[model samples]
Target: MKYSIIISFLLLTVCLTAFGQEKQSRKSKNPNSAAAEKGLIKVSVMYPFAEGKTFNMEYYETKHMPMVAGFLGSNLVKYTIEKGLASGIPNQPLPYMAVGTFYVKSLDEYQAAIAPNRDAIRADFANYTNVAPVILVSEVVR
Candidate 1:
């Protein structure tokens, strides 16, 4: 009888463990899980400064980024703007005047959100910088 009770207890414990693992797997499979678990894609727009070029930081911060946020809405998880200070090499010119990074849950979401608004966004570029912007889309691994 004691042996039978021990065997039954072991079976119950195994069943509970398996059930808990299945529940965890289901939660992870959920689309609305934590942002880190979902992975992120970054879109970087870089503007290289030239000696005779123009870049309106005021308009970019005041107007352009706001418009971008409006268009992208919730799909734009977050964003950051960085002003280039100087190159690590002493006295060297900065490679880029400004860099804007936009993060989203997935590339597909970014493409969907940006496709329709591409022309509008491009039109605003002239108001901010004369330099042609270099765009890079990459996945965040870490």
Candidate 2:
């Protein structure tokens, strides 16, 4: 009888342990469960300008960044990187580049914002550079 009780207790403990583990696994699968899972999805756009196009660089830094930030403000986290230093290679020119970031509650918000203002955005950079900028989207997983 004592051996049977011990065996039954062991089985109950095992079942309880397994149940807890399953619950934990399910929670982890939830995207909003962990803070790390709720990072910013950044849509990056890079523009490569032609030579003697310093005006393009100024437009981004002085005009575009400010206008965009006015809408985003402190609600989003952001950064920008520009590469203009010479490499001494005559053929290869250093192009102007900038990245604008906006943090939203979900991917839907990101999509919605871009859908309407897409044309206005492209127009905003118009008359600045002949070459179209490379736009790449990314998420901050960490």
Candidate 3:
């Protein structure tokens, strides 16, 4: 666990340094790039890893996400699903079991669509994952 923590910190630091430099350089070249992305928002639903948590990737990928996309329709620009493999160290448990994200054109539109079907969405959660989802809503920077 200690080794995993150390590796996580090292990997995070390296990634942040490289990512910051790249974004800074690109922003300098195109000052309006960030401004253009201001209207877009990202909604991430993350399922944290736990010893007994269960995730049905097959259902999440083939059914759950598709239903979400269908609900959002034109409001959603794109959506993606990710499966966790490692936690920065070899043989270490993953930090998250799965993550799903939506890049939406309009937050208000997305909310409007989601509000009506929220119950159905929540109800379906049990069909794919037993772990509760952590939600994050953020404006796109670039």
Top-scoring candidate (TM-score): 3
Q: Which of candidates 2 and 3 reaches a greater TM-score?
A: 3
Candidate order (lDDT): 3, 1, 2
Per-residue alpha-carbon lDDT of model 3 for 35-101, expressed as tens digits?
7667688999999999989999999999999999999998887889999987864456799999999
**Could you tell which candidate, 2 or 3, scores higher by lDDT?**
3
Candidate 3: which stretches are off by over 4 Å?
A: 1-38, 89-92
* lDDT agreement with native, every candidate: 0.82, 0.61, 0.90
Q: What lDDT tens digits, residue by residue, belong to model 2 across residues 1-142? A: 8987787678767867998999889887885655643576666666555654433667777787666555454544555646455423333456544444455445566666556767766787764555576777676674
Better of 1 and 2 by TM-score: 1
> Which segments of model 1 are wrong by more than 4 Å?
1-38
What lDDT, from 0 to 1, does candidate 2 have? 0.61
lDDT tens per residue, model 1, 69-93: 7777788888888888876444467
Ranking, TM-score, top scorer first: 3, 1, 2
**In model 1, which residue pairs have backbone atoms overlapping below 3 Å?**
none
Worst 10 residues of 3 by lDDT: 84-93
